[model samples]
Target chain A: MSKKLLLAASAAVLLNTSPALAASDADLAAIKADIQAMRAAYESKIEQLEQKVETLSAQQDQTAAKIATVEPAAGEQVATQRPATMQRNIKDSSFNPAIGVILNGKYNSFSENEGDVAGFAIGEEGERGTEGLSIDETELNFSASVDDKFRGSATIALAEHGGETEVEIEEVFIATTALPAGIEVKAGRFFSELGYLNSHHTHTDDFADRPLTNRAFLDGNYGDDGIQVSAVLPTPIYTEIGGGIFRGDDNPAGGAEGSDIGAWTAYGRVGGDIGDKTSWRVGLSTLQADDVSRDANEDEVNFSGDSDLYIADARAVYAPTGNNAEQEIIFQGEYFYRDEDGTYEDTGAATGAVDYDDGQSGWYAQSVYKFAPQWRAGARFSQLYAGDVPTGLVGSALDDEGHDPWAATAMVDWTNSEFSRLRAQYSREEVADGQEDNQFTLQYIMSLGAHGAHNY
Target chain B: MKKLSLMILTLGVLVASPSFAFAKTNIFACAPEWGALAQEIGGDKVDIYTASNANQDIHHMRAKPSLLAAMRKADLVICSGASLEIGWLPILLNKAGNNQVQEGGIGSVMASDYVPLLDVMQEKADRSMGHVHPEGNPHIHLDPNNILFLSKVIAERLSEIDASNSSAYQSNQVSFENSWTQAIAQWDNEGSHLKGQQVVVYHKSWTYLLNWLGMEAVASLEPKPGIPPNASHLKQVLQDIEGKNVKAILIAPFENEKGAKWLSEKANIPIIKLPFTVGGNAQSTDLKTMFDDTLQRLK
Candidate 1:
């Protein structure tokens, strides 16, 4: 017991000496040195504890022998002793939340600069990433069950944008756990579950970047402060229905009035296993925003009116091997159609206004194959159909110029374990007429601390 | 319009009600072993659904929507639970929206909570340790003694949940204990020759079984707990097992056998594929026969 206390004290001393804010290289080195010292101390202390335990167990065996000779219930005594050998002192963890952190970095090379998609105004975060080596987003997550009735989770992301470090709250919400009749309620800021991939974090992506369809339609991810109510219908197969009302400050919808719902959504999904080797899911969803101002092309274009979007998503997974541990293949795709009755204003280069009443559509299909436990290869193709531009706004950002945009991407990634992954990707993108670019990317993602299980 | 509304209301009522008039308590077993155990204790008084079969690794379940559908109707949730189901069980519980089977609820049965666990980490675990569970190894069902102990706990939980069938559950548990105790004694007497034998294992999953039999694991094919075997690591393991009088290389049904096969050929040792759980093989149809098959294979 004294040794345990001494070890604790020494650990505290070493921890105190380590730098708290390890943002710089010097501070990181100092922290590494501190960890090394602590590890050495713990190793020696563990040796001493092992020696002490050995002597104590020797004495215990002698005492047990003496007791065995006196007691006639030796069999029962042995039965009880067996459990003691297997039991270990466990730490109590009732009040603390599980914490996790994600580290992302990438090296990107492009043959030409990113150009706006012809006839489509793209929002921020929808464009290609910076060229060259850079640190991507660093996410910190915390989650725990508040009680039997509810659980809460929060994720904060820090990224370097335009040479400035910007911190954003990606998601923070509380969800119901005890509602009856297969009902669940979630409230606060979260990624809206409009489509299958919309709610998934970027860290869990199969490729290093979002597909072109997601970028053009949803600004990579559509999320906002909202309340969502969903229910898993009691059925032999899997079926779910859900809806939400959001504050509409996110990309697809912007500029909300106080206490007014800017957007509303409804979605339904059905899925089941075909056999032991295959599982498939299909979903349909829609989102509507009314009397809200939306902007795109880095805030150079603006639109205000009623906008409605419809989505269809499908995914199927097949494990060629009996178990997924050996080999598996996944095919996923999503189609997006948006109809708008709004006025588009060219806020930048071409200053004009157009009374727009048209529709745009986009779709992407991808397939990923896990040929081995730690290796996966995938390819994706995305294409978009531009909307018609009024005669008054022929040269505006919304003008189609008789060309549609498309991109094809291929990637190969190696996962060292569940906690770390490295990937290489190549893509040919044609965002506008006569504007073609070849892109290459090498990326690494490492997760530290407690990461919860991802939903399928 | 009025007639249409009335017809829809009647259909809604029909779908809302359960399909069966005499509904049994719904048991959602996370693995085949627990499902088999629930069968033994629940008898005809419970409706059982096993989430993952013996061919799937419980640690890497995909949290499929079908699992959520099953969990939504569960009256009891049973799992090994020393973090063995950490990857997906929590998601199912949260999404299932069934309060009675949530953690710490009466309908939740974590078998590790009742039995002692092996391979409990002595220090704070890091990912570098390769998928180590700080609470311990959650594969506790390998020990027949631990299964006997857990049976009593399950019986009490079931009786409390379904009071009208309390007597039935109690009698089933009593019979299970009697047979299990007798089987443990017979196996012990017949399998004394396995004492002090050394074997190589693909994973630490066999810890409880080895501990029960007084056998030891000399080396592992995996370099770490969950890391796949590489060439250098296999060479190291080959050298480590030299002159150790190693009996055989053991693997579970779901585990990839490529590594074990390579090592077996190199070391000139035989590979033994143990029925790690119920339905792992043709003969391992239930809990009793599963152990019988495992003991027979090991011998």
Candidate 2:
């Protein structure tokens, strides 16, 4: 007990010596005010030692040095050597955020007549820089617990397209804590937590690219500034329900304006494990959006008004050895149904507004098997097989409706370590009648610093 | 179709029933060691769910739905905190939505807090420090003394959460303490060769164990905590170990072996993989066996 007190006293003195802390007297006040209850527990003891802080910081160089000479700690927290250069701004060092970076690069080769599957528009999604080397995505992540009531995380994506670099704030969110009834509230620009794979970073995906249904309905992944609340029901089985309101800036339901939330989403999931070898989860989710100005097929056709998308996702895993790292087989699939009640405007040849009710749906299913250490193989099949559009359309609009488009993808990857992976994947794609596009890609994903655990 | 629907309805009733859920306390342990420890204390009264198994890095876990499923059902959670599980535990906790097992709750517990921590940070954390634990070294379970401390805390916590089984928990703790002390004594006598021994380690994970046994780790394979070995750092390690009487290069079974292999091949030192937790090796089926195997391998 005395040792603990003495260490705290010595540490307090060292902290008071920092010029930053000294100058920011109000910061200490805020800290004290923030922990009124905690301050009461230690205030008497700390007050008694206030007179001792000045001389101790100067004299505690040896003390810090002595502690530094001991064995270094493991993982992220090491209180190792601190040279003289680090003396000035040391107050908030203890509560600094964890930072991490992910570098994703891929090389792709695609046969030129790169056609599209009939009646399907894959959106801004396609092979990565077909026939060239490209840095697909570089992400900078920062996260920290913001007091006991909230935690904050932000991710910024950096990408270069056509010799120009672009930066996008992929996600920035603050999640609430201490909520009653097993509830959490997340606010900011974040991926909607409706589907299983929607919230995962692209770099963490099992394959190099998004699935066909995802690319179609979600325009890749639905990311928007929103407020989300989720609750876990008090029951024996694992069940969760969540809902969100978002500023509609995403695809499929793109372009909404003003203060009203453009998109509203709700979802429920139920899951559990069987014995020790098998686990499964199934979810049903829905999103409703009012697209103020929706353009597709190169602006020749535009949609406006209400649209709704419903999705169902299910996943299961069987680990024959009961150790995931050793041998595991995973099965995942998702289906989407979309209905749009909007007016389509054809600007090109037939210039008129047609009140239309269009319904489309797509699905994808994939399975991955880890047969040996450091080796995994997976295959996925996706299709944009259904859609109906109104008449009085011209140019790209007429060409956009019709038969089915489908794709099949397969990949094999070798992981050198937990932080690095190399994968080679192939895709057989058909856009329009016999417009076959053979695509191959080699991708590398390397993470540095405090990368979080990816969701399975 | 009607028969299948009827069968599904019956299954749902069984799943949602409280009697099935309350038969035993469900425990979620972030690491295998904690799972084994929970089993020792809880016995048949609890069902232990280990999030990470032997030879799997606990820092990060594959985002598996079973993880959330276990968390949702867990009556208690035990982990080596001090940010050892900082990467995955936070999101898992929030996503699981089980307020009973969130931080500061009665069911959420960290083993590092019950014991005196080693290598506690006194400096501010910064990127330049690599992966520095702001609290202290969280690998307190490696020290048998710390395990004794944790056993008491866990038993108390279990009793607090499951009052009906208080006396049983107490008895379990007593038996465990008695058995653990005896094992520690025997291992101490056998590990006398380890006293004043010097070794090279892949990471700083074994500091508590080394300190407890009066052994020393002369060098590390990593350039810094959480960072992999670099060429210059490996070169420096080679030069540093050129003349030292280091016994062997100790690497955790879960860690990448390339660095240790390189050091071993370059320095002509032997590399020994340590079963880091229960079930880490064929012989390490439990805590007692884990330490026995670790001690035997070190000797």
Best by DockQ: 1
Q: Give the TM-score of each candidate.
A: 0.86, 0.72
Which docking category, incorrect, acceptable, medium or high, applies to candidate 1?
A: acceptable
lDDT of 1 at B63: 82
- Please give the range of 10 consecutive residues that has the lowest summed lDDT in model 1 chain A: A85-94
lDDT of 1 by residue, A175-288 (tens): 998787677899999988887889888989888889888898888888889988777778888887777888988878888988878887778898988878888889998878
Give the per-residue lDDT digits (tens) of candidate 2, residues A349-387. 565777767788888899999886468999999887555
Write down the lDDT of every candidate, Cα atoms only: 0.84, 0.76
Candidate chain B TM-scores, in order: 0.93, 0.91
DockQ of 1: 0.30
* Number of the predicted model whose lDDT against the real structure is largest: 1
In order, the interface RMSDs are 6.8, 9.7
Off by over 4 Å in 1: A1-95, B1-22
